[model samples]
Target: MSSTLLAKPQMRGLLGKRLRFHIFGAFAVSLGVVALYKFGVAEPRKRAYADYYKNFDATKEYEAMKQAGVFHCVRPRE
Candidate 1:
């Protein structure tokens, strides 16, 4: 009816007023989400990985794989 409300100057002016707040709101939301992910998932996963490697015996695993004949050297294509 009224040429799509978006074409109205009043609407544009309203959007301009709230545009900065919207941008700031989006930024705040994204930053909060990232912080939550880092604390809830990434940090815990990193800590778990560090703990796993800390007590891990790489030599034992390599020897076990060697004994099982599971280790193989791939030849390069010449």
Candidate 2:
């Protein structure tokens, strides 16, 4: 029984070539996720917050809160 023909086929490349390809692929995927988060999630959230505060009047808000007695002074802890 000759076993020469039953051997697994070998790919033509350095062993490190396959490892490098896999490492680079994983790095690319991670970078893509970070970019997606920056553009898709963080950018929209930042814009929404900016829009919400764009026309805000801090003085008027404070005055209204004061008029409504919303603030109370607390004694310092000994």
Candidate 3:
């Protein structure tokens, strides 16, 4: 019996092409994840904080806390 279809230059070229494609695809995916986190996740949180603080009224709560003075205490570090 004889074996045929040994590794050839064309095969090597095809493998190289595929490797390049995979590397570039991985890089694109990483960049997309970072962009999503920066814009999609962080922006909404920032907007929510801004909106809450814009309409927040802390005066009544502060006055109540002052009258009660039952403040939460933090233990000193040893």
Candidate 4:
């Protein structure tokens, strides 16, 4: 028989041999991404928002808006 005709089928050693390891690696990578986002992005954003609202005075803000004519509205129909 020709050498080409005697070829064996290709094995899926890359993925089929160790699927569990691949799945675990993927899960670990996803968990790391989530952790990075929580710490790097979400935590800093949350801290910034908390700091902004830390000394927030609602009545002072409302007074500023009132001076800006924000409360000038037409009367409702009788």
Candidate 5:
């Protein structure tokens, strides 16, 4: 391959504009997706968990704590 082909162009215009357009479009789409998930989907799921825990029984609570690796009792002193 010729060194001229690998070298940076002495003149640049259209290529830079096209690259900038694609980059900005991608950033806008990503921001829209994150905003939708935070405002639209997560609120109801959070409420359901809150309601479930509010009515949870001791046996169920103890099971959940065990699954999460949390224990109610402290270890005895050595």
Candidate 6:
């Protein structure tokens, strides 16, 4: 009981310092995770999709689909 009474003030100060450290550490970690995912995952996917479409023959596929009557000319837009 006497030890608890004497430790209250010290505990309060330690709590404040630890709380600040925890908050800042959490923020830094979250930012790092987001940056790593963007660079490692999202950017690579975008580049792969661009590469795939770079050599895709859009006009030839469109002509084939049109010849096969796979499309409906519902009021062509200008």
What local lDDT does model 5 show for residue 3? 61
lDDT of 5 by residue, 1-78 (tens): 586587666566778988899999999999999989987889878998999888879887767777676864743235
Runs off by more than 4 Å, candidate 1: 1-12, 73-78
Model 1, 1-78: lDDT tens digits are: 677666535644787779889999999999999999999999999999999999999989877777777857733235
Each model's lDDT comes to 0.84, 0.86, 0.81, 0.85, 0.81, 0.86
- Cand. 4 Cα-lDDT: 0.85
TM-score of 1: 0.70
Report the alpha-carbon TM-score of model 6 versus the true structure. Answer: 0.62
Backbone clashes in model 6, listed as residue pairs:
none
The CA lDDT at 59 in model 2 is: 85
Candidate 6, residues 15-37, lDDT tens digits: the string is: 88998999999999999999999
lDDT by residue (tens digit), candidate 2, 1-78? 686678866677767888899999999999999999999999999999999899999989887877677877633235
Count residue pairs with overlapping backbones in model 4: 0
Residue-wise C-alpha lDDT for candidate 3, range 1-78, written one tens digit per residue: 237666556754798899899999999999999999989999999999999999888977665775676556633235
Query: Clashing residue pairs in candidate 1, if any?
Result: none
For candidate 5, what's the RMSD? 10.0
lDDT of 3 at 25: 100
Better of 3 and 6 by lDDT: 6
lDDT of 6: 0.86
User: What TM-score does each of the candidates earn?
Assistant: 0.70, 0.66, 0.54, 0.66, 0.53, 0.62
TM-score of 3: 0.54
Give the higher-TM-score candidate: 4 or 6: 4
